[model samples]
Target chain A: MTKNLSNVNQIIAKYQGDQSALIQMLLEIQRENRWLPKPVLARLSQKLGIPISQIYHIATFYKAFSLIPQGRHTVSVCLGTACHVRGAPRLLDRVTDTLKLNPGETSVDYKFTLKTVNCLGCCALGPVMVVDGEYYGKPSAKEIEKVIANCD
Target chain B: MKKLQKVTLTINDREVTAKEGMTILEAARDAGIYIPTLCYHEKLAPYGACRICTVELSRNGRSRLVTSCVYTVENGLIVKTESPKVIKVRKLLLELMLASSPAKAIQDLARQYGIEKRRFEADKTNCILCGLCVRYCSEIKQANAIGFVGRGTERRVVFHPEIASTVCASCRECFSLCPTGKLPSETDGVCFDDLTLDDFLKTQQSPA
Candidate 1:
């Protein structure tokens, strides 16, 4: 947690101490840290002199920022038309069963966060799952278990 | 008049110089190094949402990933706009963005990169974080009626409180800007083909 704060401070410093760059800076910070915590928001508010309420508002308003701690691995399922017609729902169910978590929920051990997306644009490979920045296409229920095992 | 400061930098191992305030993207373009980007136009300020223009820069012997669109050229900056790491990150970013918004435009680009399947399952939700509609309605059209509501994973553009009416003019400015044609309409509720809300908003504006 302290490390996250220090990282936020570094980001704040990169913006030349400007609060207006809050959104972009926070985006970058989140990219590095995976998620933003409330304490970090307070620190940003104090550093930038912006009200904590305003920071909270902006944080809540943007779809990019997350208030909770994210899992170590994030699995995003693509449900584009091609994927949908190709049994993406079945794949989603398999993933949820394998991970034991619902969509948008993280595993109890924080090993994985399961999420579903509209489309990955790779229709040729329906039922795509992107895990920890790695792409996996046309994965079956069994294949997903192998992939998760490989991650471990 | 304030004197414009010049900064010398290296892009793709080639030496080039640019104005201090110039973005690394501008300097690279001037130097003939092409960096792929979306949501970045010369006429508008950099949005940095695409994350495709990320470059690996080594400054003071430390390296970091910086978006070329927003990063300014600095003296002694050694930048590699295209590297193995940079390519990987760009591809991942593209994959993530594509997953969020399943559109023909995104698919075409993904095909170019040989991304056959996203590693994750598909999300049924249609909203992508492109912010094009938000920008058009708020910035270009100056309507500011519909804006992004919700945060992180649940973020979406809707009339406040998910109600039908608030500030939305229903000019369909957002509909046109939407890449997937998934904007909400009154006719069929959430169906893509329904445009009753759009028509109603138009009627409200003209009010014959």
Candidate 2:
């Protein structure tokens, strides 16, 4: 809803018309807005003079970027080797059941977005999850229910 | 050589200057401030996989938490590397990382932090906390030798569907880089040339 292109324009200006900063600038904008809309990408394309296809390509290339809407809370489950052997699949099942949505999907109320990551580099805590960038380790299906309840 | 632009930033109340495009970790180290980090080596680009180097930065009246390894230095930036909030967050992040990785090194670090047993249930997975396997396979190796499959709790790193040696070199690069000994040897001739998904899974069950 930040329709006033002032901030976005300001960001563009700060980069000194460098199109290379496109991805970085987009990341900053998305961080503030939560999700990138088509209009914003088009605006970026117009300002940077880059093709919308190229912009979309770069956006899709990075796992961090998302074209669809994301929830207020982002839940990232680590699916590294350690977590996998430790029954991470079961944990994921629990999360899906509780949230009533699979990975890469958002909850019905738009409160949570569930994602699975390869590794968070915190293998010490197998079966790890990051809720809104806050790490939660060694969670059980039952424990996940409590965690989700606490989030509410 | 063209001199890189240098920028001054404050980290944990200490003023430090570093070359433009340098990560917050490099800047903090140049300023003699120690910020614990894993999965970050001076020889490599910042991967931002490990959440241990999370720091709070304030620039132009706006503050945010970011991984110092991936965050670049900006002029007139204010950073807090160590504080109660940061410590708490770091502790939790480390704890979470530990739960997934049951490597001895990870456990040793946990002990240093006074965490004897994990607060959360043990994941009992074979993924060691070290990110070498993932990093080498994805970034340096460019083989995508393995990748995370599934989502949410079911997420895991595995050879692509119909795992074939054509997709993987079986060069043992991942095995060497793995901090844990989870990667099995490829001496079995099956992975030497090309392997099918069934062959790979069967290999995992029976080692070379």
* Best of the candidates, TM-score: 1
lDDT of 1 by residue, A1-152 (tens): 89989988889889987977999988987788777777787788778976544564576566456666678888888877888888888888888888888776767687887777787678887778898878888887788999988876
Top-DockQ structure, candidate number: 1
Candidate 2's DockQ is 0.03
Name the TM-score of candidate 1: 0.48
Best by lDDT: 1
Clash count for each candidate, listed in order shown: 20, 18
lDDT of 2 at B203: 32
lDDT string for model 2 (B1-208, tens) is 8889989888777678899988888888887898887677665567787678888887667777888888888998888987666777777876886777766656665666666546876675555344565456556766554554223443344453223255454466566555444555322312322433234333322211
lDDT per residue for candidate 2 within A98-146, as digits (tens), equals 8877777776687988888898888888788888788878887778888
Candidate 2 local distance difference test against the native: 0.68
Which 10 residues in a row give candidate 1 chain A its minimum summed lDDT?
A: A51-60
> What DockQ, on C-alphas, does every prediction get?
0.07, 0.03
lDDT tens readout by residue for model 1, B9-111 = 9888889989979999999888888888766666556778778889999977789999999998889899997788897887787688766677776677677
- How would the docking of model 1 be graded? incorrect
- Model 2 chain B TM at 0.72
